[model samples]
Target: MRADTVEPPARPSAQAPATSVPVPARIAAHGASAADRVAVTGPDTTLTYGELDDRADRLAAALQAAGARPGSCVAVLLPRSARYVLAAAAVMKAGAAYLPLDPATPADRVEYILGDAATAVVLTDHERAGTLPAGPWTVIDLDEPRSLVPAPQTPADPHIGPDSLAYVIYTSGSTGRPKGVEITHANLANLVDWHNAAFEVSSDDRASQVAGLGFDAAVWEIWPPLAAGAALHVADEGTHRSPQLLQDWLVEKQITIGFAPTLLAEQLIAAQWPAHTALRTLLTGAERLNRRPLAGLPFTLVNNYGPTECTVVATSGEVGPEGNHPGPPSIGRPIPGTLALLLDEAQRPVGEGEPGELVLAGPHVGRGYRHDPERTAERFVTVRTGDGETVRAYRTGDRVRRLDDGRLIFLGRLDDQVKVRGYRIEPAEITSWLTQAPGVGAGTVTVLGDESGEGERELVAYVVASGDQPPAAAEVRAFLAAQLPDYMVPAHVVTLDALPMTPNGKLDRAALPRPAVVAEPAASPAGESTDDVKVWLGELIAELLNLGQVGEDDNIFLLGGHSMLAMQVVSRVRQRYGVKMTLRQLFRGPTVSAIAAEVAQQQQEASA
Candidate 1:
């Protein structure tokens, strides 16, 4: 079913009831009282609540001194560091909306966001300060001596309303450009309050910050802790790759609360939990939470669901061995102070057991998009129920069924939205880039190849060669490099003579061919010189391809070595030989001996 094209139920009400809150005081109150508590922990540094608040105050004062007006957009480009959190808080404190520009984002994309938002000021560290596109805006570097100057104390502004824009998050737009979703301070405050009350976050709780600063998940990673006087431990980029290191850090830091998507949680589960960790709450969201990942984790496992436009989260459910039931756990019930309804195409409430689009209504709803009024009107609409009451509800493009017990069961997305690395992706956007390459024709992409217990889905693309010319997979990848980000690009591209069609004549994605397997080479029968290297490559490829007798000349891609498998191969290669091999190297040299030789050469050069 086409999700975005599916017409939603008509609005029940002509107008939505106004639900807004005061913004500045909420943050100030939390900051003032918990200033001395630990707020953020990074690789080798820790910022107490007091330190964070002070830094934010200084930054806000600087912005205000530079003539930044309330509601103005303040763009931030930085890594996942403590400064990013402080800068966001500072933007809110200054009564300006924060726009997080992810460092990993392409320069052109970042320029588009800054221009669209008409950013008044930008706060970045020295490393990324010069990377921003040329613009007429004040730039403040946190590392500079001038940035350390403390401005006069600006009292908390009580005038900032809940409906005021707190931040703007840009989603991967299917139409080739990113669209910004404007979230208000009131919306964030409501979400934080809901989480604090529901999860019972206390001053003693320590939450882990794993998601990137640019995503909505970061809100959950940052605010709940500050609001509840709890601590937040920021995981470094390297920690995300090493499950063992992450597990050790989680235990050593005594993190009581953290959230990861089911994929990462499954990885942790597979690696086995460390003996010393004391995790009280393990919240999973941004994707479906399967049962296997939560099977033996000694903590409360919460499966959460919500869109970026609806604050951090709107619904959550607890999962455990005793309560384990069925395929995927229910999304549970609406969060406190939130209303969830299942409605059919007619905007009528669906009866129990009937499938419908899930609609969310509450104060946690964001302030709509930044500059796209038409797009905003299309997604966010007011719906009236049978009771003749009006509420502003976000039409979540999710297909769901109301369970007999009132819980909502996730069916699937009603649109092209797919989760990759816990970030929502629109396949159309990725396909647009793929089709731009020379010799490329109609391209249809779908996420297939999910591990038995892992919730992560691997993206695979099926393309019909244009006319008589078909572009090589490598060339297509090179073409995509300039047009799209790494995550959006398909890991595997399969050329098809013609796509299979359903009875209705729609493309039948299930009939696509899986990549052919190629045998990796066995060790030379002549000598012991290459024994250990051959043995290692054989074991790695065997585990990846689920086969033995891998020939030396066997191509990795032909053996079904996609990006994820390539990463696994690289990690194992690095661990065994103490040498690094890039993803490109693996693609170029798909054989054991070739890759081993390349690594050996690099090691020799380093030693020289």
Candidate 2:
């Protein structure tokens, strides 16, 4: 179960020659070969290589015709679908930088990103086009099937150099605004080449697109396969939710390579794979990888580490059973073209076994954040190494140590930035909102997750109530919804009698409650209608709350069931019985028995 590191593989010979074209051209060149295959699979349909290329070419032509000039920032807002991928390809092909907009992002946030980036146009499907904010921006609908009228082949614009910007990915900003990271063609190409070469990828290899297009991980998922002439399988939202479906899709499509955050990987492990699975290499990054779930997987698991400033990844290590013994496996050595240095606050190299900030320098380093010179210069700086080489290193803000074996062991962030479900969450922003909630006393919130040196952890909130009566979980959640996004909300809320403090009276995060997992019991014996409903409702509530048990009168939201989970319970209730109820109705009733009575009443009304 241990990975053996042999000497680095021989690089491609001078005669073999690497492709010098930008990423879009490289993809086009690969797609030109009829034999080259790129299949994007979704919940309902799949597109072949020819179809994908044709669609992208058509969209690119359309973009050009629609006045999208070179270097223009074209915002893209679409769900995880083929259209999203094709639109991205189109934007690149049109010689414009694609700005990704996450569907789950708030409308105001989307507006801020678009305005901040000064996007010239937006390419989205019919489903999401209307959701865009009202502006003087040009929008292209890719969902509408247009005739693939071959446009005049515009000669490859040689002016677009490798150093030119390719895309701008916006990360959640700590200061109430989002910051866009400008990634260059060279940066992306280097990462794609490194990943493909490191994994020995081939045209036969198939990879999964699990992360959303907005996430930096999606860059790894998309470009690597296309650059290597391999296949990229796109999984829809539902497919991503069900681990079994993901495994089945991977097996059915013969996926040989894939990447996901540690959170999604843990879900795959919890779902329990079949006796056999066909994953050759599973890459996890953007967050720390837990060792427990990765132990028995029948694939070579690699832990990739890097910030968005370092393109996709700077360092990667193979996870194995032997390496799992000493806490967790190392973050592995730097990739071939990358140099990882552990530097102190003064930017001096820290000794081996001493913790310091991780700094990265290489071809994969991205250009500083778009249009934010002050913040950009703060993090990205030039430093002279002990070897007397001056290189631009990105201060990752990740605390780490160089182990005796030359691998880096990640400790945690020096800042308040924490990773949840693979996305970085700034505690300052979350706490800013939590402290403002009415009835909540001066509150200091801390994020706890599996990456926090424990098992898979969700967000848990420990609040100090203002008065004798504490606000309900529903009210707190409602307040959070107005300020924070869904993923940033704490999954569990513990109304602490008082906030725990450290020896010096600082907020103690370690004392927070770990998310409790509730298991479902075996089905009960056939019984009276009311008793049967009570047992079923109790089990449902327990599962919803992630609690060991639930009483008939226990309030659902009070036990940590959020609005989303309330809807899920309602859906499950409808599926079990031929009855339907709305989330509002569930909130009003607020109890399992109450919901059951509503369902029973609805069923009776329908029958009558």
Per-structure clash totals for the candidates: 9, 1
Q: List the residue pairs that clash in candidate 1.
A: 3-414, 21-162, 35-50, 519-551, 520-550, 520-551, 521-550, 521-551, 521-552
Residue lDDT tens for model 2, 323-350? 3344545677787778888899999988
- What lDDT does model 1 reach? 0.69
After superposition on all CA atoms, what RMSD does each candidate show versus the true structure?
13.3, 12.1
TM-score of each: 0.70, 0.70
Q: What would the TM-score be for candidate 2 when compared with the true structure? A: 0.70
lDDT of 2 at 409: 74
Q: lDDT of each prediction vs. the true structure?
A: 0.69, 0.69
TM-score of 1: 0.70
**What tens-digit string does per-residue lDDT give for candidate 1 at 1-608?**
32322221211111222334333454456568866677788874788877877777777888887656677899888777787888888888888888887776778988888888888998888888877788978888877967646566653452567667788888767688988888887787777766776677888898898775666787787877777777888887645433445677788889998876544553354345755668877776765443434356666667778888898788776654423354445667677667888888888998767888988898778878788899888889999966889988899888787655556667776765777776678665566456556566555667765534267677777664554344577787778777777887777876543344322122445555555422123333322245566667877787778886687777777776644566557645654555656544665577888876776676678779
